[model samples]
Target: MKYISYYHNPRVSNLLRIVSESPGLTFTEIMRRSGLANGVLSHYLGNMEKRAMIRSKKGRKMTWYFLPHDPIEEDSIIISLRKETSKNILTFLLTKKLATFVEVTRAAKKSPPVVSITLSQLQDLGLIKVTNGFVKKYEVANPDTIMRLSEKIDSTMFEKIKDRFEDTFSYF
Candidate 1:
């Protein structure tokens, strides 16, 4: 466990504070909320990361920034789900509990191929698994951890992402 000293610069301190408050926000979210320019924010984050003051979970589309030392377990499943599409899929599965591929495809409003790839990715990350039973359903490996980890992220951001996915379901 590394103990990092506080940042002297206010902007850097503010960035750290923001990440601490919203542990699972992406780089875009941070920029939007912090009102910091790309180069400046990037520089501060890089410094923080090198000092072990902050850490990030890199996703396919974007990296989810977080404090290096958080109370949450920082499981790989949670890290992987930091990606927008993956988080959207997990949110869908968590709400429905158990769903078939067709059902997920319909609810997520994502193309069949995209949904399929996301499902396989989730399974590979150990966040979810496909049942071997007759129905061949998908279910989260640990709903409890998902729920707990969900509490650490910004609800507004999560809701926005969720709403976009839900809108797809509404289309059908």
Candidate 2:
């Protein structure tokens, strides 16, 4: 007899529940929440995406997965900032208000390609904007949102842990 469907797998159901409750989560965040190994999670995520059960937004630093209709916005920016270099670049821009590419590279203390990819990712998320004039300068599009994210990043750990146990008990 055929095995029960993949959808019946506890891990897959858990993953779906996680995405439904907290859409726009990064792969690592999903893995952490689900307690899945990298290779296994990658395979399951790929299958889910292929079947269109979920959607993912790819970035230089992260890939955010969510239900197809969930809006990403601020959550996407949070994932980007989770990357060390991207966070440094954004932090620098937030302070300077606006700065040219060279200034950002210097401030981030990362090589051109690294800075370039980070900036591109930020631009893609609409978290930062680039203006074309004598030179291209980058600025944080929404300082308040980013400032809020920066403030809340460390504070969310307890909530995440609590949510894990909550989900565990939810099945009872």
Candidate 3:
């Protein structure tokens, strides 16, 4: 509860802001976003995690950070949002409520196979539910939670990722 209050230190506040806005971020990712030196960031992150101000998950190759209260399920959701097709499909379903494979394939604007796999992955993540009938249907499992996670991970970060992919082409 105390972590809910504003920090007197701007650096800590900025660090928290970055993690809160973009959960499931690796250590290097957090450092890059914060523009803090390696030693200082390492110290701050370690201290915060120790103080129960933030949480970290050890991935195979890296450690991802999140707000202290974020559930483990949110890790995959935030990661998936980094991919365009997944986010697009999720957003579409969130709005559409329910749609068949054909409708989703069209809305996702991806190849049928690709859409199929993405839908499967979404279902595996429990973000979307599938209905079996004359036609298979897909819909968001928990609209409120999905929407909140979508909102939690900053869209601006995705734009930054896009810029990197575009590689200076966006400047003009």
lDDT for 90 in candidate 2 is 78
- Computed on alpha carbons, the lDDT of every model, listed in order, comes to 0.77, 0.80, 0.81
Candidate 1, position 52, lDDT: 85
RMSD of 3: 8.5
The better candidate by TM-score, 1 or 3, is 1
Residue by residue across 1-172, what tens digits does model 2's lDDT show?
Answer: 3339877878778999998776667899999999999999999999989988899888777788878765555667666667689888877777677899999999899999999998998898889999999999999999878766665554463344346446656888
RMSD of each: 5.9, 10.6, 8.5
lDDT of 2: 0.80
lDDT of 1 by residue, 1-172 (tens): 2335447677778888898876877788899999999998898788888888888877577787777777445646556556667777788787677899889988778899998898888888778989978778999888777766776664564565457557767978
TM-score: model 1 vs. ground truth = 0.76
- Displacement of residue 12 (Cα, Å) in model 3 is 3.5
lDDT minimum window of 10 residues, candidate 3: 157-166
lDDT of 3 by residue, 41-129 (tens): 99989888888889887857778888988887678887777568898888777666789999999988999999999998999988899
Best by lDDT: 3
Query: Clash pairs of candidate 1?
Result: none
> Model 3 shows how many backbone clashes?
0
